[model samples]
Target: MMYTVQSSGMLLKRFSANYVQNSTRLASFRQCERYGKFHDCRKRISHWLKAQGEQVAQACTKQCEFIIAQRIRRSLQIFHLYTRIWDEVALKEFMKSWRNRALRNSRHFLMSSIGITMYNWDRERITKDELNGYKKEIEGIYRLRDSTVVCAKCQLRIVIDVRQSGIKYCTCTDNKFNATSNQDSEGWKPYIEREDMLIWRREEPNCGGLFAYKVYGSFAEVTAEDFLQAQIDVDYRKEWDPTARELRIIDTDPASQSSADSHSDVIYWETIWPKLFANRDYVYQRDWVVDKERRLIIIISKVTDHPAAPSKPGTYRVTTYWSYMVIRPYTEFHQPGIEFGLTYFDDPGVNIPSAVTAWVAMTGLPNFLIRMREASRNYQNYKIAKQSLDASDTNYVPLKNEDIFEDKVLHGNMQNSERSEILNGKNVEDYNKIEHTEVPQFNEDLKEEEEEEDSTNSSEEGRGLLDYFYLAKLFA
Candidate 1:
C-alpha cells in the first residue's frame, strides 16, 4: 500500500509541469499577434497623412499661379487703355493742323496777289523787264526745292524734294566727280577771306541787287553732330544768340511727312535790326538729314506761310528766305572737328547800303559762328544735367534717338555700266534709285516743354539785342 501511494505523487508532479509549459507558450503567441496588428494599423495611418500633405502642397502651387495670371491680365488691360487714349489725342492734333494750314494758304495767296498788282502799277520805281527778271530769279530759287547736290569732298548724294517734304541721303562710292573744281560755274564770286574761312557772294537782281553770302570754314573743337544739335536746339539758341528777339517753333511736320531718319519744323525767328530799322521776322520750314555712315548733316530752311506766325505790326516780315548748311567731320591740327558750308540769303525789306551789308556779313557771321561753337561745347554738360533731372521724375517719358546708325545692306549693287553712266551724268534718274532699308519703328513719345521761365530770365541779362546793332552806327 505505501509503494503505490509514492508512484501516484510522482505522476501528479509530471502532469503539473507539462500544463505550465503549454500555458506559457500560448500566452507568448497571443502577445506576438497583438503586436503585429498594432504595427499594421500604424503604417496605414502614416500613408494617409502623407497623401493629405501632397494634396495640400499641390493646392498651394495652383493658388500662386492663379494670382500671378490675374496680375498680368490687369496690367495688359491698363496698357490697352493708355494706347487708346494716345490714339485719340493724335487724331485731334492732326485735324487741327490741317485746318490751320488751309487758312494760312488762302491768306498768303491774297497777299501775294496784292503785292503783284502794286508791283505792276509802279512803273517809275520798277520797269516791267526788271520785274520779270526779279520774278525769274525767285522762280529759280524755288526750283531748288527739288534739286540734287553732291558733296565736294565725299561725293555723297543729297536730294531735296520739298514737294515730298523729304530729304534723302545716299552713299555714292563708285561714282566720282569733282564738284568744287569750278566755283565760278555756280555764279559764286569770292567776296572775302578771313583766317581759314572763305566767303562767296551771289547777287540777286531783286531787292536792290543785294548780295547773298556763302561761307566755308572749320570749327576747331566741335563735332559735326554737336554742331547740328546746336543749330536745331531752339532753346539753346536763345541762350547764346544775342541777335534773336523771339524764336519759337510754330509746328512740326505732319506724321505722314515725317520719317525715322528725318525731321521738319515750322519755326518763327525774329532778329534784332539796327537802331533805325525795324526788327526782321521769318516764318520758315526747316528740314534736316543725318547720314551716319558719312558723318554728315544737312540743314535747309525756306520761307513758308503759317497762320500761327501772322505778320506782327512792328516787325518786317521777310517774304523771301532760303538757307542751307552742310556739315561733315574734318580733322585739323590732329584733332577731329567739323567742316561746314553755309549759304544764307533773305530779303530784309529795307534799303541798306551794299557796303554796310557786305561789312556786316563779313564780321557778324564769324562772330555768330564763334558763339555757336562755344555753345556746342557747353551742351554736353547741359544735356547730362537735364537727363538726370528727367530720370528723377516719375512722369517723364524719355525720347529715344532714331536708330538710323544701324548697319544696313545696300538695296542693290549698281552694275559697272550703271556706275559709269552716273559718273558721266547721263543717268540722272538713277541717282535716287537706292531705296532705304525699312527702319524698325518705335513708339513716338510725347515731347516735354524744353524751356523754363527761370532759365529764360537767368540768360536774359547776358543776351543783349543791342550788342548786335552797336556797330551799325559806324556805317549809318
Candidate 2:
C-alpha cells in the first residue's frame, strides 16, 4: 500500500512540471510571431515612401525643364520682333532713296536742256547788240554824277540806272558785309526779339531769296571756353542735339595741326526731318580760330566736298550751307558770361515757305542756344569723369583715334572697297550698340583681396589638432 501511494505522488509532480514548460514555450512562440509581423509592416512602409520620393523628384525635374523652355521661347520671340522692325525700316529707307534719285535725275535733265537753249539765245543777242554799236556798261549808276556807262546808239547821253540794270551780284560777294566783324550790318532787319536773345534777317539776293539769319545772345554764368568746347565736341553734341541723326568728324586738316590756335575739321552731319520731308545731310568744312589776346573765338563752316563723305542714299545733300560764329567774354554783365553772334543760312534741297522758315528760325535758334548753355554747364563734370576713367584703366584704348588728322588714321587700315561699303550703308554697324567692356572698380578689387585674405585666415584657424598633425607629417 505504501509503494502505490508514492508512485501516484511522483506522477503528479511530473505532470505539473510538464504543464509549466508547455506554457513558457507557447508564450515565446506568440512573441516571435508578433515581432515577425511588425518587421514585415515596416518594410512595406519603407518601400511606399521610396516610391513617393521618386515621383516627387521626377515632377520637380519636369517643372524645371518647362520653365527653361518657356524662357527660351520668350527670348526668341523678342529677337524675331527686333529683326522684323529693323528689316522694315531698312526697306522703307531704300524705297525712299530710289524714288528721290529718279525724280532728281528727271528734273536735272529738263533743267539742263532749258538752260542750254536760253544761254545760246542770250549770247547771240548780246553779240548782235555789241556789233551794232550798242555797248552796255557793267556798273549801273543812279545819277549822271557817277555815270561810267555810255550808250553808243543815236549819240544819246543817258545814265544806266541801278534799278534798271540787268546785271545783279550776289549779296555774299559784298565786301562791306562781313558776318564775323559786324553783328549789325546794313540790310539786316530785326525779325525776332526775345528777352535774352535777338534775331535779324537779311534777304539773300542769290540764294533763291532765302533770308540769312543773325542770332546774338548772352549765356549767363558760362565761360567762353566751356561754351566753345560744348559747341565743338562731337561726342558731347550727340547727347544734346536732338536734330542730329548722325554727326562725325570724317577728316581733319593736316595743315592746321601745326598751329595750336587754328583748327579745322571736315564733318558729316545728317539731320532728322519730319515724316514727309526727306532728311538733309551736309559734308562741311569747319574752321575755328582762337585768339587769346582778344579773348575772341571765331568759327566758320561752309559746305564742302570730301572723298570720304560721299552723299549716301536716303538723304538730300545740302549743296549750299554757311555758318559763322563769334564768341567772346561778356563784360556787360556783372557775372561771368559769354556773348555769341551766329549767322547761318542753308538752301535745303526742297523749297519751304518763307513763313515756315522764319518761324523755325525764331523758335529753333533760341531753344538750341539754351540747350547749348545747359550742356556747357555740365561739360566740366563730363571732363573730370573722362579723365578719371582714363587714369584708372591702363589697357584702355580709344575706339576712334584722337589724332585722326592723318590720312591713314582716318581710313583705319581698311581697304578702299571696305570703306566705301561702310560709307554707303552696306556694312554699317550701329556704333551706339557696341557694348562697352566693364572695367573692374578699384574699390571692388581691394574688397575682394581683403575677403580672400580673411577666408585663408579663417580656414587656418578652423583646423583640428589631428588635421594639423597629419598635414605636418605629410609636409615632413
Candidate 3:
C-alpha cells in the first residue's frame, strides 16, 4: 500500500475523536503527567507508520525493476530471432532473383515495419523511466549486432548503423549506405591490439556464452584473390599452415555453383599440438562467398557433425565454434598488397594449460599470417611445374612455328640426317616420321616422403589414440 499525506490526514481525522476524548479527561484532571503520556503515545504511532511506509516504497521499487528486466529480456529475444530470420530470408531472395528488386523492397519494408511495431510496443510497455540505469545496458546489447536493411521506396540495398540511425529501417532514397559501394565502411572497434594487428572479441548469441575475435591486418604481396585461393586450396594449405598437420576434404557438394548460390564443403582438420598436449581435430562446414560486385571474398566455417568421420582417439575434438575470413583490396597506405580480416573462435574439448595457451595466443596468429603469405608465393612458383605436369598427363601437343631461320636450319639438318635412309628405302620419308617426346622430371623421393608422412600422421582406421573422448561422451 502507498502512503500519502492526504491518506494520513484522513486517518488522523478518524482518530481525532478518541484523542479529543482523552484530552478532555486529562484537562478535567488538570494533570501534567496525563498530557505527557498522551503526547508520547501519539509520537510512537507516527514513527511506526513512517517505518511501514518506507518498507512499502522499497518493495514497489524492487517490483518495478523486476518488471523492467523481464520486459527487456523478452523484447531482446524477439528482436534477435526477428533480425536473424530477416537476414536469411532477405539474402536468399535477393540472391535468387536480382531482377526483382522492387518486390524485394516491398517484402523488406513489410518485414521491417512489423519488427519495428513489435519492438516499439515492448519499448513503450517497458516504461523508460522505470528502467533507470538498465535502459542503456539493454539498448547497447541490441545495437551490438550489425543491422541489415534495404530502402523501401528505392529498392536499394544497404546496411545502416543501428546505433547512429536509432531505427531498424533505412530512410535512404539515394542509397548512401549502399552495400556494394561501402568497402571503406568502419570495422569492429579493437579491444586487443598488438604489433599493428587489431583484435576484438565479442560475445555472440546462441553461442553458449563463448566469444569470437576479429583480427585484421595488412600482409605483404597478398591480394584478395591470392588469400582466397590459398585458403581454399587443399594441397596449398599444407604448405603454409603449420598448425594443421593434416587437412582433408571429408565431402563436398558443387550443386550450388550458380551465380546466386554459394559453394559448401565439409573438411576434416587435425592440428599439431605440443608433446604433452593432446592433438586437436575438427570437422567443419565451410561456405564461400566470392562477391565480385563488392570486391570481397568471404569464407565462413562452422563446426558440423559428419558421421563419415567420428571423434578419434588421442585427440580432443573442438565441440563449438565458427571462423570468418574477409579479403579486400588495400589502399595506398597498404599498397602492393591486400588486407585480410579474420575472425575465429573455438572451444577445445579439453582444458588448456595456461602457459601454452598464452604462448600460442601471443605468437601463433602472427606466424600463421606470415607463413600464409610465404605459402602463396611458393604456390605461385610451383604452379609452373604443376601446369606442365598436368599438360603431360593430358598428352597436350603444342603448335610450333616453322617460319623462323632457326626452325628452317633445324629442319634442314633433320632432312640431311634422314637422307641416307630415304635413299635406301622404297618409301623415302617413312624413316623420318617417328615422333620425339621429352619426359617431365619430378622428385620421386620427395613424393614418397610426403605420402609416408601423411600416413604416419593419420589415425589408423576409425580408432583414436585416447580413451578420454569415449568416457566423456558416455558421461555426457
Candidate 4:
C-alpha cells in the first residue's frame, strides 16, 4: 500500500498544474455536441428505449436500463484511462479498493470460470483478464505514485475502477449519477456530430476556459504505429494540419532519454489563424508512450516554461491547456483500423468569446480531422510506393502530384483554373467535376431526444461507471 514520491518534483509539478476543479466536475456528463447541453445517463438510455418503441421501453425495467447505462459508463472510463495515467496516492488507494471489490464481486457472482467480457463503444470486447491486467498496471504505479491522474471526462483528479466503480465525478458534483427508473434525471447532451467526429464544449467554471472534446476516428488502412508516428513527426504534421505554421522541438528532459520506450521533449507550436484573429503559439512538454501489448498510444502535451522559447509578437501565447491524444485499434465497424480520441482545453489568450469559438469548433473541426485522415493515407501510400521501386528509375519515379503538375504548368501545357484551359482534350471544368468527392457527414441525431435532460440541478447524480460508457456505447 506504499507509494513513491518524486524527489525531483517534476511529476508533482505536473499533477499540481493540471489538477481539476470541483465546479468542472459536472462537465463529465457526455453532452450533445450541437446544443451545448448536458444529458443524464438515464435519458440517453431512455432515448434508446423509446427508439426501440414505446412498448419495448415500457417493458424494460428501470433496473435493466440502469444496468445498461452502467456498462456504458464503465466502458467509457476504461477508454478514458487509456488516454492518460494517474498514479497519485489517493487514486492508487481507490484503485486498490475497487480492484479488491471487483475481484470479490466476481467470485460472489460465480465469475470464477472463464470470467466475463465487457463490450466498449466500438463493440470491442474487454475480458475480465484484460480488466485485471489494467488494474495490475495501476498497482504497478506504486513506483511513481506522485503522478496524479486528471480525469479525462471531468477534468478533475480521479481514482478509476474497472468495474462496479469508483470515481466518475469530482467535487463539483452535478451530472454524476447511476440511472434509476426515474427518467426525469438531469444530464448533458450531444451538441454536434459530423461523420465520426463529435464536438462538445462547456464553459468550464474551474479555469474559465472553454473545454472542448473532438473525438474522431481514422479508418484508413493505417496502422497504430503509422498514426502515432505521424502525430510526432513535425514535418509530416505540417502537411496535414493546415493550421500548423511552425512546429519544432525546443527542449527535453535530461532524465528521459530518446528511445523507443518513450520520449519527453518540449515543443514549440505556432498555428495559423484567419486574418481577423492573431496567430497562436504554445510551448509545452510533450510526453509520449506506446503500450505495445495493449495496442494503445498516448501523447499528452501540457503547458510549461522553457528558457529557450519566449512569448513572441503577432502570436498570442497560450498560457494554459491540457491536450492529450489516445490512439487505439477501432475494430467495431471496419477492417481492424486505428481511431483517435483528442481532448483539449485552452484559454486562447485572446478576446474571443466562448460562443464564437464553439461555433468555429462545430464547423471547422470536422474538416480538420478529415484532412488528417487523408494526409495519413497519402503519406502511407507515398512510403509504400517508394519502397517498391528504385528512386533512380525514370519510368517508376514516385513524384508528388504537385511536382508533376508544376512541370506541366511551366511548359504551358496547362493553365491555371482561372483561364478555363484544356488539358489532353479535356476541359478544366470536366476534370474538376470528375475529381470532386464529398466527405461523409457525422450523425448528429444519435441522442437528440435526450436534449431536454439538461439540468445542472438534477437530483439524480451518476454513481457508477456505467454512466460514462452508456453514452460512449451510443456514440462509439
Among the numbered candidates, top TM-score falls to 1
TM-score of 4: 0.41
lDDT of 3 by residue, 1-476 (tens): 12243355467669776544356643544454445546778888899989899898999999999999999999999999999999999999888787676564654465556632111222222222422322122112112222212334543323422121212334464434433222113333323333223344554566544445556454445444445656776665665444556787765544443323245567788776656678778877776654433334556677776555578988778878666665543322112244456667777655545555444444444334444555554554655665733643211112112232222223223332333211011121221122221111111122457445444433231133222121111000
* Model 1 stretches astray by more than 4 angstroms: 1-183, 256-260, 331-336, 385-476
lDDT of each: 0.52, 0.50, 0.46, 0.45
**For candidate 4, lDDT tens digit of each residue in 1-476?**
01122222345556687654454432432222223434456578888867878666666777698999999999999978865565466688899999998874654344336543221112222222432333222112211111222233454432222111212234453535322111111211234444433333344566655554535353535555556656666666665454567888765554445345456667788766556667777777666665544435667667776545667877788786766676654321112245565656666666556566555555445444554555555665655655634544221212123332332222222223333211011111221121221111122132433323422112132222212111111010
| Tens-digit per-residue lDDT, 1-476, candidate 1 | 33444455456668766544366755665566556646778888899888899898999999999999999999999999999998999899998998888775765566576632111112212222422232222122212211224344444333211111111234463333322222454666555544334455777775687867766655545655556666777766776666677888766665414354456667898878756778888878776665444444566777777656789998888888777676654321112354566777777677767677666666555455444656766766766666634644321222223353322223213233332212111223321122432111111121133224323433553344323432211100
Per-candidate clashes come to 0, 0, 5, 39
Ranking under TM-score, best-scoring first?
1, 2, 4, 3
Worst 10 residues of 3 by lDDT: 467-476
TM-score, per-candidate, Cα-based: 0.46, 0.43, 0.40, 0.41
Tell me each candidate's RMSD, in Å, in order.
31.6, 33.8, 28.2, 42.5
Q: Clashing residue pairs, candidate 3?
A: 313-464, 313-465, 313-466, 314-465, 314-466
- Count of clashing pairs, candidate 3: 5
Which ten residues in a row are the worst by lDDT in model 1? 438-447
lDDT of 3 at 77: 100
